[model samples]
Target chain A: DVKVTQSSRYLVKRTGEKVFLECVQDMDHENMFWYRQDPGLGLRLIYFSYDVKMKEKGDIPEGYSVSREKKERFSLILESASTNQTSMYLCASSSGPIYEQYFGPGTRLTVT
Target chain B: DQQVKQNSPSLSVQEGRISILNCDYTNSMFDYFLWYKKYPAEGPTFLISISSIKDKNEDGRFTVFLNKSAKHLSLHIVPSQPGDSAVYFCAASRGARAGNMLTFGGGTRLMVKP
Candidate 1:
C-alpha cells in the first residue's frame, strides 16, 4: 500500500504570517501536487512538482508556492498567510503513466 | 466556467438499494475519468476509473459508466451501505498531459439511510 503523510493535520496562523505545509510519500512517485479544497469549489490545484527543483503553477497558484528539494518530500509555502487562504490543504502523489494518485490526510489551515 | 459539473448537490438513498451519481464534462478532450470518495476531514480517495476506450469499468460494488458521445459519466453503487455515504467527486483528465492533472466537478453528497 502507498502511504502519503502530511506534516500537520491542523494549523492556525495569524494574518501575514508565513506558513509551511509538508508532505512525504513512501512510494517514490515522480509527481507531487498541492490542492486546496473548499465547499462548492471542489479541489483546485495550487501547485505541482514533476521532479526535484521543477515546479509548475496550477489554476490557482496566487499567494502560494511549492518546493521539491527531494523526491520524497514536497512542501507548500504561503508567502503571507491571509484569511482567504484558510482551507483544507491536500497533498497527493502519483507514479508515471498510472495517473492514480494517493492522497494524504488533509491539513485544515485557519488563518486568523 | 466549470468544465466538470455535478448537477445534483446531494442525494439520499436507502440502504441495500442502488445509488447512482451522475457527472458531466464540457471538454471533449478529456479521455480519462475517475471517481473519488471523500469524508469530512480526510483527503479524497480514488474509488474507480474508466478510459474513453471502454464504456464501463467495475470494481467490487462500484461501477463507472462513460458515455463518450455525451461527454458524461456515472458511478453506480449497488447494495449501498452506510459506509458508502460520502461526498463523491468526478474528475477528468487529458491523457496527453505528462502529470495527468485532473479537473474535478463540484462533489455530490450521498447519504445512505437505513
Candidate 2:
C-alpha cells in the first residue's frame, strides 16, 4: 500500500517565524506536490516537484517554497508565517504525471 | 478568474438516495477531469476521474460524468451513506507535460443522513 507521512499533525508558529513542513512518501513516486486547504477554497497547489532537484510554482506560491533534495522526501517552507498562512498543509505523491496522487493526513498549522 | 467552479457550497441527502454534485470549468483545453473527497483534518483523496473522450466513468458507488462541450462535470453517489459525508472537489487537467497541473474547484460539502 502507498503511504504518505507528514512530520506533524498540528503545528503552531508565531507570526514572522520560519516554519518547515516535512513530508515523506514510501512509494518512491516521481512527482510530489504541496497544497493548502482553506475554508471553501478547496485544495490550492503551492508547489510541486517532478523529480529530485526540480521544482515548479503553483497558483498560490507567493508565501511558500518547496525543496525536493531527495526522491522520497519533499519539504515546504514558509519564509515568514502570517495569520493568513495558517491552514491545513497537505503533501501528495504520484507515480507519474497526471496520475492519482496519494496524500498524507495533513498538518494543520496555526500562526498566532 | 476562476477556471473551475462548484456552484453549490453544500448539499444534504439521506441514506439510500442519490447525491449529485456539479462542477463547471472555463478552460476548454482541459482534457482530463477528477473528483476528490476530503474529510476533516485529512488531505483530499482521489475519488474518480474521466477522460474527455468518455462521457462517464463509474467506480462502485461513485460515478463521474463529463460534458466536454458544456465544460461541465458531475459526481453522483448512489445510496449515499453517512461515511460519504465529506467535501468534494472537482479538478481539471490540461494534459500537457509542462502544464499538466490540476486546477481545482472551490469544493462542495456533502452531508449524508442516516
Q: What are the DockQ scores of the candidates, in order?
A: 0.75, 0.63
Per-residue error for A1 in candidate 2, Å, reads 1.2
- What lDDT does model 2 reach? 0.91
Model 1: which docking level applies? medium
For model 2, how does the per-residue alpha-carbon lDDT over A1-112 read when each residue is reduced to its tens digit? 8999999999999999999999999987898989898877878889999999999999899988889899999999999999999999989888876557888999999999
Residue pairs in steric clash, candidate 2?
Answer: none
Give the per-residue lDDT digits (tens) of candidate 1, residues A21-96. 9999999899999999888888888998888898999889999989999999999999999999999999999987
| Candidate 2: segments with Cα more than 4 A from true spot | none
Displacement of residue B81 (Cα, Å) in model 1 is 0.7
The RMSD (Cα, Å) of candidate 1 is 0.8
For B5-99, candidate 1 gives per-residue lDDT tens digits of 99999999999999999999999999999999998878899999999999999999999999989888999999899999999999998786767
Q: After superposition, how far is residue A44 of candidate 1 from its true place, in Å?
A: 0.6
Give per-residue lDDT, candidate 2, residue A35.
89
